[model samples]
Target chain A: MARSTYTLTIPSSTRFLEDARQFVETHAQEAEFADTAVEQFKIAVDEACTNIIEHAYKGNEDHHIDITIIIDTDRFTVRIRDEGESFDPTSYKEPNLMELAKKRRAGGFGVHIMRRLMDRVEYRTRGNVNEVRLTKFRNAEHRRNGDQA
Target chain B: MSNFSVGFRSSNSIKVLDLQGELDAHTASELEAAIQKCQDEQHYHIIVNGRNLQYISSAGLGVFMAYIEEVREQGGDIKIAALQPKVFNVFDLLGFPMLFDIVETEEEALSKFHDAHEEG
Candidate 1:
């Protein structure tokens, strides 16, 4: 159960990604999360939003990305909800770095970064909305291994 | 706010780009345009100085990936230098260190260009 939950909504545009990251940074810092965890959460949220703007909304910039920050006794989570296109998790493949560079591709790295930084990354379809939930836990094992990524 | 910009600094034949402010999806296009301009002007040996770069996302990294092959194929390289630890961590997270010439100082990046020139 969450002890506290905060929400932020931004226009579905890449220009607003920094605001989303700043919101995460302030709340995560106030929560006294470890520095590494705070950084991870920020990047994860940014990537999630970037994916939504580019892939989900397809750069339409007319939609909204609803962000909910859930802080519990044991975990900190960022749930990003968007009304854009639904993502197919099964289609996600870990990108080959060299292959992408060789092909002159500039994307296909955001989801991978989100999955590595957060302890859990979940996708859900509720009615017409699409949500990608990213969570990082407070634990000794996590603290020890989280930095490995 | 996005608030990102790139400034150009030239050292001999090398073009050094000073990157500042947040770098994400919208602002990444600015970086891409700067690089594109460099390519257009036939300046291929490039160094990105990120001392003032406050943040980055995968879209920002993607710009580098998109330009790297073309730059290298032209017998030039993109050397990244002086990134803030946090900014560099994003690059590291995506395994950029292996595919990029990342150095701790602008001098090192410049020296790399010098070394290549001397080798020629």
Candidate 2:
């Protein structure tokens, strides 16, 4: 298991979310991860990109999202980068199903979902660029340790 | 071009929507629009058949959440049925089973609607 990295760049629009999903599906499968892990990566990556497109870029198709997949012996990592607005982790609140339903809201689920599916969801801001790294452990023991990510 | 579509039909007075293709941020609006049409027509006893639906994202699930409370308030409910295991897993991950009447088959969902009508 040499560390292998794959990258894809898509415009900041919802339309390309499917493309981002397929990109993860293809590479994750190629990495020979279990079907369940592959599915998890596909969804976590989709949620991350959906957040970047909807909230960070704010529907501005002029922006682009940079996705880098790093396959390591211990983990499968996805690094997403955007030059648009940075996400404020402190402002994020766990969504309550009843509260969202009462408000008739359609969003606020992407971040929660991304964190749910990935073993580690880390966000950082470097200058004007924002990056979020979503990682899933390659081994069962490691995955169990990340059960709460 | 969008790779998703919603087909509308009726089964025993309950509106059924056949969802095909991937449902994500790009395609959630179609489901929302379809559900909206059902709501506007006062057809709240809705069954979403996900047999042919191969993929889904949180945005897709959000559509159901956004409308479920409203429809239920109107004395109607959105029932999801026949989802592929992968899609159902996503719903489960979000605790949707607790909030939604997710069944294994469309007939199962239809019967629930019928059962409710009988009780009412």
Candidate 3:
């Protein structure tokens, strides 16, 4: 599979989240993501980065978030790796959406939304380090030809 | 720590939060903390006045989603008012209107809250 990758290390802050999203969106723009997919991808990156800033760094804004963008003709894969601790996002149960809708809870829904938006989501932890990988595939071949699908 | 300002006030039994500037991943936490404070104080009839809010990313939505349960558990609700069309479109696309009672003005939200309180 032909792939290209770029990695960045930055403090676990929202600024980094913007940079990361911009990087992904800019690269993905070549494929022209559908408006909904663009929005979803932006949301997924924001949530993942927020998790790194909140849970991984534990409010310490000094640590770096190691982010990798893997691009291919068929899909874009974003991998977020942090050294803070071995935390598995997959272990976090999908909060009941029925209850979520009834109650309007805010925080726990990020991972759930990310899972919903991405084509593939995997989480693994090793040696006290956590990694979250999200994949989104390009389906609109018409858009690839610069035609809005 | 993202660039934004957040303030809260109470008017006619409605707690209003004024969020200005960008509400993205970076600045959503500040809003979250403020909302939590209101919830912690048992103030559930909340109104988010976003007239000056320029943008709201998914990260921002995550914060509100976090508090959905807290407000409802108290027999209260969170209402959004004066969302810019762009922001509203995002909310609409994400189906926030179904989850929240989004209104066009602070006065409207206040009236609704008053009506709900009276009816209950």
Task: Give the clashing pairs for model 2.
Answer: none
Query: TM-score of B chain for each model?
Result: 0.98, 0.98, 0.95
| lDDT at A109, model 1 | 90
Off by over 4 Å in 2: A144-149
lDDT of 3 by residue, B14-107 (tens): 6899999878867777898889889778888899999999777766887888787668888998899999886787677567787778999999
> Model 3, A40-62: lDDT tens per residue?
67667777888778777886888
Error of 1 at A117 (Å): 0.5
Off by over 4 Å in 3: A97-106, A125-129, A140-149, B7-16, B32-45, B51-76, B82-99, B104-111, B117-120
- By DockQ, highest first, what's the ranking? 1, 2, 3
Error of 1 at B57 (Å): 0.6
DockQ of candidate 2, scored on C-alphas against the true complex (2 decimals): 0.81
Which candidate ranks first by lDDT, i.e. highest?
A: 1
The TM-score values for the models, in the order shown, are 0.95, 0.96, 0.70
Please give the RMSD of candidate 2 to the true structure.
1.5
Candidate with the greatest TM-score versus the true structure: 2
Q: For residues A1-149, could you state the per-residue lDDT of candidate 1 as single tens digits?
A: 54999999999987788789889999999889988888889899999998888888998988999999999988888999998889998899999999999899888898899887888899999988999999887875663235554
lDDT of 2 by residue, A5-96 (tens): 99999989988988888899898899888888888888888899988888888888999999999989888899999998899988999888
Better of 1 and 3 by lDDT: 1
